[model samples]
Target: MSKRLRSILTPIIAVLLGIIVGTIIMLVSGYNPVDAYTALWNGAFGDVYYTGEVIRQVTPYILAGLAVAFAFRVGLFNIGVEGQFIVGWLAAVWVGVAFDLPKVIHLPLAIIAAMVAGGLWAFIPGLLKARFRVHEVIVTIMMNYTALHTVNYIIRTKLNQGSAKTGMIHESASLRSPWLQELTTHSTMHWGIMIAIACCFIMWFLLEKTTRGFELRAVGFNQDAAHYAGMSVNKNIILSMVISGAFAGIAGAMEGLGTFGYMAVQGGFTGVGFNGIAVALLGGNTALGVFFSALLFGSLKIGALSMPLEAGVPKELVDIIIALIVFFVASSYIIRVVLDRFSKKGVK
Candidate 1:
């Protein structure tokens, strides 16, 4: 199969196998598997409102998925995407509420602040890895906690504009579109989705069309080899982290500006950042793949909440199904075994 064909088929097959396994689990648990899936489908795409909600959920995933996928291409395991995302949100919102400007300028400026914050958040760990030869995984993982506490401190302080959250962003700076709001009284879905789609194309262009991307990929496959081949291994690694963090920053901007319109004290780590890991994997760490996978996940999430009302199942059941799918995808040995057995039967 062509690489593109395989890239599309692999995830589809994995999802089917995951569904089969989930069915078995549900049957064992005394639930009707067919009913469960039916509920999921009806809940997610049953109506226009539900469908819009799915779009809302997927918007952030696109950016977060790109964040992880970009880092993966550079051979860096970034475990602090959650941290970078939060810092981005905090920074963007700070800019959004702290100043007043023209519509075109204010919104874009806030978004830029978010990107800068996210890049700086990731830079510290990148520096630690490059300068001290520290393991990037360990360094990035620790940085997640640092981001969590640092943001929490800022939120509790007056930095949040004398409230749990800053005042509502200026109407001029808002990304709210009247067209989408007509469906749901209010939803977070906004122009961020357009930006995310554009970014996906940008990522594809960078990876396929740019020399810097080639150097980054070279470093990822083999740093020592890349070093010998005239590539600056350290610089590439640092650049990779910068790009990765900037993607996460855009994710923060989507949530704070598009959805919330203000900075609020984050009660906890939003799972979206961690969820980026799975999206990256399922998408094959590619730009186009991440876009579709993000939509899939967004649908699954929107459906998860509706399943309870439609099927009398807990929302967590959907999480369990997703977890199983991710687990099976990670352990391809199972799929290999299944495919091997089917081949043997054909030979017989």
Candidate 2:
């Protein structure tokens, strides 16, 4: 089969397999799979409010997926996207609360703060990987805890109002659109979706249409060969991590500015950053693939809320299905080999 066909079929088959396995689990657990699935669909798309919520959930997933995919494209593992995301969220919220400029200027400034904070957070690990030969995974993982505690302290000391969260941001810095809320029947959807979509196009253009992207991909394929070809492998590695962190930061900004309009101290990881790894894998690390995969993930997440309410199925079942899909995607080489054998037989 052609590469394009394989790319498309792999994810489709994985999703089907996930659903099949999920159905079996539901049956064994004494629940009707059909009813659960029907409820899932209705919850995700039954009304304008649910659809808007799905889009709101998808907005951050797209950016976080891009963060993971961008790093993967450069052969880097940036596990600290969670940390960078937290810092970026805090930075954006700080700027949003502190500033009182016009909407146009204030919003951009808040976003830029988020990007810079995220990029700088990732830069430390990238620099260590490039200059000291330290493994980025360990450094980034450690940094995640550091970021969490540091941000928590900052919130308590500086931004807190006898609560765990900071004060609400100014209206100019808010991404909420009253008209959109009205259209969606008061769903939390915001203009951040536009920014996420723009980032998708930007990622596609950069990775598919630019010389810099070619260099990054070359380094990912084989660092020695890229270096032999006169590319600065170290530079590209650092640049890739920075860019990845920036994407993750923007994802966090979506939550801070658009969804919550403030920052809060969290006890643990938000899961969005970690989920991006699965999203990138399922998306085949392509921009367009990321967009669709994010939608699927978003739908599963938002729709899961109705599983218990509508069908007496536990919401955790949806998490299981998501995990199964990722597992199938990860084991796709087995599927590819099977497909190749069938193709060979047909050709004969």
Candidate 3:
């Protein structure tokens, strides 16, 4: 099989296997898989409100997926997306609450602040990796804790005067749309989805059509060869991380401005950043793939909520299903071997 064909078939096969395994698990657990899956489908698409909600959830996932995928393109594992996301969220909300400008100015300003904050947060690990040969994984993992506590401190001591949440952002800065709400029976859908889709295009173009993108890919394929080709390995490394962080920051903005319109003292991590790793892996680290995988994730998440009410199946089953999907994707080598055997038999 061609590389492109293999890449396409791998995820499709993984998804099918995941569903099949989920069905077996449900059957063993004395549950009807058919009813459970039907309920899942309905919950994600039965009503206009549910459909709107899926889109809302998907908006951030796309950006977060892009963040992780972008780093992967340059051979970086940005485990700090969570830290960058949190800081970006905090900065966006800070700008939203602090400003009193027109929508044209205020909204863009808040979003830009989020990007800058996220980029800066990722910059530390990137710089360390480039300059001192530190492992980015370790630094970014440590930074996640640092961002969580520091944001909590800032929220309690500075932003809200001991409250767990910050004040609501001004109307001008909000991503909420009255028209969309009306259309979706008052779901929380907003303009953030548009931004998310635009970023998808931007990522595609940058990675596939730009000189910098070529250099980044070269560095990722083999850093030694990239260096011999006279590319600035260190510069590309830093730039890739910063851009990845910027995308993650936008994911946070989708929550702060579009979903909640404020920042809060997070009891723990949101899990979105960590999920991005799975998303990037499932999507084969491509922009188009990320978009589709994110939609699947959004559907599974929104649909799982209905499993309990409709079919008496636990929502946690969906988590297992997602995990299985990731496992299968990670084990693509085994699947490829199977495919090869089948292909040879067919030819014979």
lDDT (CA) per prediction? 0.84, 0.94, 0.94
Q: If the candidates were sorted by their TM-score against the true structure, best first, what order would they fall in?
A: 2, 3, 1
lDDT of 1 by residue, 1-348 (tens): 244555566677787777788788888877777777788888788877777677778888999999999999989999889999999988888887878899899999988998999998888878887778888889878888888888888878767667776778776667779887777545556778888898899889998799998998998899999999999888888888989999999899888888888777777789889999989888989999899889888888888786677776677877887887788678755666666676578789
Tens digits of per-residue lDDT for model 2 on 260-348? 99988898889888988888989999899999999999999999999999999999999999999999999999888887888789899
lDDT of 3 by residue, 204-312 (tens): 9999999999999999999999999999999999999999999999999999999999998999999889888889999999999999999999999999999999999
On lDDT, the leading prediction is 3
Query: Model 2 lDDT vs. the true structure?
Result: 0.94
Better of 2 and 3 by lDDT: 3
Candidate 2 residue pairs in backbone clash: none
Between prediction 1 and prediction 3, the one with superior TM-score is 3
Error of 1 at 332 (Å): 2.6
Stretch of 10 with least lDDT, candidate 3: 156-165
**Per-residue lDDT of 161 in model 2:** 78
Candidate 3's C-alpha runs over 4 A off are none
